[model samples]
Target: MKPSNTIKELLDILNSNRIGGVPVVDDKGQLVGMVSDGDVLRYLAPKPLGIAGLVYIIEEQ
Candidate 1:
């Protein structure tokens, strides 16, 4: 996937297929980066409540 992909397109691919992450590639398909579900959350969601969600956040890790 190119860095130019829209958020909607990335989410669509993950949601529709129930995936965790997608490898970002260039014209040659060489791995460049990864877009994970966590990365999406980190974008759409606000920063963790350091104290309140601490347990949940730690558990997630």
Candidate 2:
């Protein structure tokens, strides 16, 4: 797929019963990576930005 494709499209595909996790294949269909609902959720989990920033500042000081 083109890089311009949006995550919404991928989410639609996941929601549909037409396919399972999207096969992150190369141009030759060789599996390079894979994305599923769980994978997406894990990747999109809310991070603790405030705590992370505080830690970085403290370490630098």
Candidate 3:
């Protein structure tokens, strides 16, 4: 699959074919990388908010 493929497209391919993962290739059909459902889920998962700084709330005087 090419990098341009959308998330929905990838999911569709994986689901319709009942595949857990698929290989990504370049224009030459050379292997570039592999992507799995877990990877997709992780990427789509919300990122953590680490090291919260000062957050102040102001009130109407």
Candidate 4:
């Protein structure tokens, strides 16, 4: 699929469905990347990648 797909369309399909993120795939359904609400928000946020803020990753004990 292409990025030209609207967020509204994605949300409509995502509703009543359970998945972590939307797999951005080529026409053959091969995954290119994923797009979750979290992914979108992160990109929109005022922070650089791999930088820590209110959220941080913790190694499992």
Using TM-score as the measure, the top candidate is: 3
RMSD to truth, every model: 5.9, 10.1, 11.0, 8.1
lDDT per residue as tens, model 4, 1-61: 3566786576665654765467788777788887886765565564664645424421210
Error of 4 at 38 (Å): 0.7
Candidate 2 lDDT over 1-61, as tens digits, reads 3234466777787777666577676677677777776554545544544666656643653
Q: How does each model score on TM-score?
A: 0.70, 0.53, 0.71, 0.50
Whole-model lDDT values for every prediction: 0.78, 0.61, 0.72, 0.61
Q: What TM-score does candidate 4 get on C-alpha atoms?
A: 0.50
Model 3, 2-54: lDDT tens per residue?
97898778889998999999999999999999998867665654464233311
Instruction: Return whichever of 1 and 3 wins on lDDT.
Output: 1
Error of 1 at 33 (Å): 0.9
User: Once model 2 is optimally superposed onto the true structure by TM-score, how far is the C-alpha of residue 49 displaced, in angstroms?
Assistant: 14
Residue 49 accuracy (lDDT) in model 1: 61
- Worst-scoring 10-residue span by lDDT in model 4: 52-61
Error of 2 at 46 (Å): 4.8
- Native-structure RMSD, model 3: 11.0
Instruction: Please give the range of 10 consecutive residues that has the lowest summed lDDT in model 3.
Output: 52-61
